[model samples]
Target: MKKINKLILMVMITATAVISSCQKLDMPPTNIFTPDIIFGSEAGVKSFLATIYRALPIEDFKYRPDQGFKVGANDWENFYNSASVTGEQVGPFGGMDIGGGFGYWPYKDIRNVNTLIEELPKYANKLGEAKVKSLLGEAHFLRAYFYFGLAKRYGGVPILTEVQDPGAPLESLQVHRDKEEATWDFIGAELDLGYQMMDETNETGRANKYVAAALKSRAMLYAGSIAKYGSVNFVDGLARAQGIVGIPADKANQYFTKAFDAAKLLDGHYSLYDKNSDKVQNYIDLFLKGDSPENIFIKQYSIVSGSAHSWDATMSPRYMTANALSRSYPTLDFVQRWGALSVTNTDGTPKRFNNRAELMEGLEPRLLATVYFPGATLRGLTFDMQRGIYPSFSGTAAAEVAKQPNTRSYILAGDTKTLYQGKMVIGFTGPWTGGDELTRTGFYVRKYVDAAKPIATVDLNRSEQPWIDLRYAEVLLNKAEAAMELGNASDALTAINLIRVRAGATVYNSIDIDKIRNERGMELAFENHYYWDLKRWRNADLVLNNTRFKGLMPYYVFSENKYIFLAEPELMQRNYNFDKRFYYEPIPGGELGKNPNLYPNNPNY
Candidate 1:
């Protein structure tokens, strides 16, 4: 059998953390640090924990729906992100189907965390009992996190807590799947242990008592949702019979209670960021500011540390960025969910405006913060998003909706050089006649884009804004959803209104499940929550069933000398379809072959 020290080195080498590039760590020889050397001191233990934090399955900006968590640093696949799969945005790639995940099996990382939990107690004398317990609590939080990632994807994965010996018999090594209910119960229990054992505060990115509870608030909400809605997309299979892929609908309230209680524990610990009186700017700064009180937990990055992302370059308008233009454009369908845009008249004729930017007047400030309308400024450049020049139009707005390109009377500009009456027909930053790198929806994403970053410097691997994983807003949303589910409408209304008050939107006078859900969607838009929220609510299939998301097109009326916005199907006319079987991703085929006990796979694999 190999020495435990050898196994420790193997795990340490795979450690990746957001604090710094795992590859650029200035460390001595790996073989020098054994289990004793690693767990003996506070600094050594921190180094070990860094690796565990690095392995967390955070679906941040790097996550691609067609792929999985943590795409390659250089891969431009971040362009096709989770927002596109949902109705949040229409991207250049990846329609509705996100096939059987990216074969994510993190048991090896789980074992490393397990090894720390199992072995750390031996050095309690050197690192005081309180310190040891605290570290162990962090380890438990990590283990629960890894399992949560699996539970959300492939339901009821094997609950492997102990570090199993490799020399054990094959039958002992191959564990059978737990019931889906038991899996969520285990996750809650582990989080409870973390909540009880950890401290109230720690470093920004590190887990603490409140952070553990915050995760419980999020994770238990997911479990409660699965219990209530898992039957909506049920399939008759051995896995269902064994309780591997579906939860009992009867236990939904029990899980909702847990979610509500977990969320309540964080009531006084964090707050919604409200530094700026300007609601729009306050909302924008909430994501950008690292020191905001709203942040429960975040994944830190630094360009100097060589851990950076391409969000700014990929999301910025073509004219705003020097490299890598916009790929995903928000849909008008999603924009309308917040509230109706004032772009149509009472008779259904398209509303004509002297300035195209006036289309956003009297709209929610939160919506304005989330997206850049035609005249919104970024990096000193106004986003001039004009699609075509219509010489004349005598018909209603309904007639122009989703009309074929070649047949429309509107003279669409073929290129940037096309001129109508000595002025460029299409804006430099375009919803142009044809091409990528332009906003097809006549808008751009303003959320999370660093307005302070110089326009010329925006490129791949240049963005270093920290990804806020858990925030106080989400906790409140979770509490609100649970309260609504538990029939406490007053509490639900209060929680929902807190977010709305901060957002400068109209607060609800009454509450229901749909209202609670819509607030969650609007509040958490493009943070990569909508897709999962839809899945847990079992509404993805109904929402995306042959759905063709619409885009807002701005047309310059050449004869009238004004602009009119038209709601039209996106240029590609791509149809997004969601099969019901996608609710739970299929168990990885490789894992099933390795251990037959892991069968039967999820429905319709």
Candidate 2:
């Protein structure tokens, strides 16, 4: 059997949590695929394709790019010192670094699927035919997803059906990347094929009519925004959003209807995992459990006892021994963005909150599932954070920091250290005197990681595999979004309320387009949807960098290291409202290297 690169994969995923690279880790093999080795048997096909779902960097919550994604004010400045770009800035794009060694390489997975699509006919009517068809749908859905990623990141990418040869010269590469419009069209069409071929009754995590509908809704949303908001480099690119029109308004409504219907089909089939049903129940526990209804498709992981990528272990805080050396410390601004005090109302609206106690005073149950503050008393423990107990480190740990001078002593704050915008709890301050940074910087991410699993020596099992990537909730949100755009606010309300009530968040919330947007933002925070959400709405620069960036978290600062939000006023100038150019990313360098012909760069680059 081929062994998975569990260690390397874990490392790659770990990098994202440590540093906000929202792209999920993509793993692919170099060998050309053949039906004989791929779909010939259930085991062969299973092993070959399972990795696509498994390799997704979802369990690691830091950069899962959902609506709640955040970049610190100073941290964004840091990113800026690293790159070069123009136009309206998104939260992370000031100097967001790309062209890195690792990225979510969708083409790699698609190549495998394309190979099957091209060769699967040989087994027509074979016993494996059923499985092949299902697998084929999975392949196309995955390919659509990859292209979705491509379209979102670079505004459109080359859609390669077959795997590229490593030795193929650049000139012989023949295919040029598609424009955003053509690619979205191809992606939407491919997803239609996948949905047409899929078994809707399959596992919740598996793709079905619901998943495709959800994807289409997302694609349409992106297309509409980009078409409406044309930017530099393209003379007539404003017409690219024509794809949205291609999928007829009624067509979109039908797809959305199926998505909602499928989700409703799974209703009661899966209930929200609300253990203890208490506001204090840990958030990480949900993801740690395998196959919860909330999870649409999942990837399995374990600590030392069983096999799992280090998605959970690596992101845990320093106080948890497992994470000290390998911490996924969150930026203070991110913690603040998470809002210990309060979240948007059940209808997805935000209200001002100052402290964790106020947030916990009378918060809904679902909001508590993801984050917790020190003042929020639970289990009679009060989950307090002692400021002096955290760590401090002064070395080359932050060697390449773009704008700020690095290294200094950091003592823990009660909870203020990581998100000093003002809160009750204190986590790890720095790498210093008795300070444990991993947990210190990150107060809590209880979305995954099962604490119920009897603690083993080093690893915890009995925990369910992480349904890491896609979820049914997302489908419902997708349905709501499309319904709203299609002018059916009432239908949008129905979809949004279903998710809200599940989280115990639907008390006084209203149902409207703006309300649904906020609800989606809160419900899908950290699930890796924010960048695209911002892009689809054309609000990346507005929300990501402007009103959201709270600058360097100073609560953890000690007398030793000197750090402060330098341009606090400049950093504070966030644009909560969005801009046009913020909708698309520039084409990548490597692909540009391959074909400067079809892949004209988005001027934002």
Candidate 3:
């Protein structure tokens, strides 16, 4: 097993109390150490670094659309996620109507990182030069990461490279946001610098050369997409003049090339995890097993250290979860988009299934692995998701008349009964309403669930499963996307085919940008990638404009003794409108109030 270092544990345990105690009193307390005393020791430096790591917006298991990175205990009530916004999934209640906003301004964390970058050199004598450089690299990587998160959400933002004095003038402190291209360039430079300075060898759960490279691959890809596809007309002249939100189209290839190169650097170090013969189980285990080589970087958790999340408790099937509410319902649009599992079809056509039992037949393994469809088993319980049952009309006069609509014809009179005299009847899992735990869509989420954990007895914040943020498969997808954007179709197919083969799906003989995007959506579904992917590709408006995602309803035909499936509009009225201005999230109103220089907040605000 890969070990999470004791340093991380120490940081989690000590930093919260130390940082909190330091700020409790205005004046210097006798118990608290001065900055000089803190930075003078190696352990203190490690502690500081640990705090910064903890502050990072890694967007792990606890990430929610409404809450940003850190989730409150009650935030689970607003359970919609990135998948909910994207057409990939819906919530148990219905479609999430919440406004799209990611108010992430981690200036405090950035300031702390700037302070570390400035103070690290002072400790060079206590820590060896090599160690100091590594520390500096980590600090730089964190800064780059911080900015990248902002850039992806709000375009260019104020780049604070050094620590600012508390007494600094208001004019000096109100730094204007840079142009989008410059900010992205700065991020790339910082990641490159960290990659050059960091050691190839590092302990687990710490930033290494590969981690920096993976981040660069992801950041550069986002930059390239913005340059290639984003519209510049949304912002006003003043915002455009400051370079706050637009990139030149000419720079697209350069960013894509950088992303491709960065991804290629990890070729020998990591590959897709394919240890299990059962491909579906193998895909599930990819998220379940923390020690897999596929995970390039992860945010780990430990119940002993008081670090864990409630992902399984919140996302598991109703019967499986202690809370008994199934959030994040997989959508029929995503299921239909999975296409067929047949390897012989070069055109990527979806296969036809004659009956409900065969509905999942010829589907991609990843689809089966990602979504718990009707009749799928989870946590030792079969999900008998029968919307309703066909009435027994053999001898009745009502049966003699033509069949009514599937919705009106089926009866919810009792549990679904078969012909056997004493046989048990399976209850419907629903497309039902009037309850919290019932699924509005026909399916439930399956990815990122800890199958090993006992969900029925679990409580909040007790799940300790690690969340994989950067992995080999995503890097491969990145490489393929970049290559496709660069007009290298053959190379793109080669990279994407590796992912497809592992997913137990057909390999594409000829591919286009759309095909690559589709492949990415399937492979990385519900991992917090689809929404961003759609945004970066400039396709969200096209895909989600006034769209209501679809769902499937399964009904038991008692006379035929077989289940029949119908695909139609989801049970609930889901409205999704992606305004063009939403491509760039608005800067927080409070931040603008503090500094008027941070004006002209991203278009439609």
Best-performing candidate as measured by TM-score: 1
Shift in Å, residue 425, candidate 3: 8.3
Candidate 3 lowest-lDDT run of ten: 17-26
* Global lDDT scores for all candidate models: 0.82, 0.45, 0.72
Instruction: Please estimate how well model 3 matches the true structure, expressed as its whole-model Cα lDDT.
Output: 0.72
Predicted candidate 3 versus true structure: per-residue lDDT over 517-597, tens digit per residue: 888888888888887887888877778778898777665656666665555566665787777767778888889999888
Better of 1 and 3 by lDDT: 1
In candidate 2, how many Å is residue 322 off? Answer: 4.8
Per-model root-mean-square deviation over C-alphas = 2.4, 11.0, 7.0
Q: Taking the tens digit of each residue's C-alpha lDDT, what string does model 2 give over 184-274?
A: 6787788777778887655423556545655665665665555543332232343234331122233434444433443444445445555
The residue-by-residue lDDT of candidate 1 on 1-605, one tens digit each, is 15456567576443334732111223332432587788888767777777777788888888766667664654545567778878788886655657457788899889888888988899999999999999999889889999999999988899998888888799999899898889999999999999999998875347888888989999999998998988764556778888988888999999999999999999888999999999999999998877789988787665765667888999986678878667788889889888778788999998899987788778788898998889888999888888888888767888776476577887766677789887678887888567646888887788888899998888888897878889999999999999889998998999999999999999888999988888888889899999889888888888988889888888888888889998888765788888887888888888999999988888788
> Which residue pairs come into collision in candidate 3?
179-243, 341-362
Clashes of 1: 1
TM-score of each: 0.96, 0.64, 0.87
All candidates in order of TM-score, best leading: 1, 3, 2
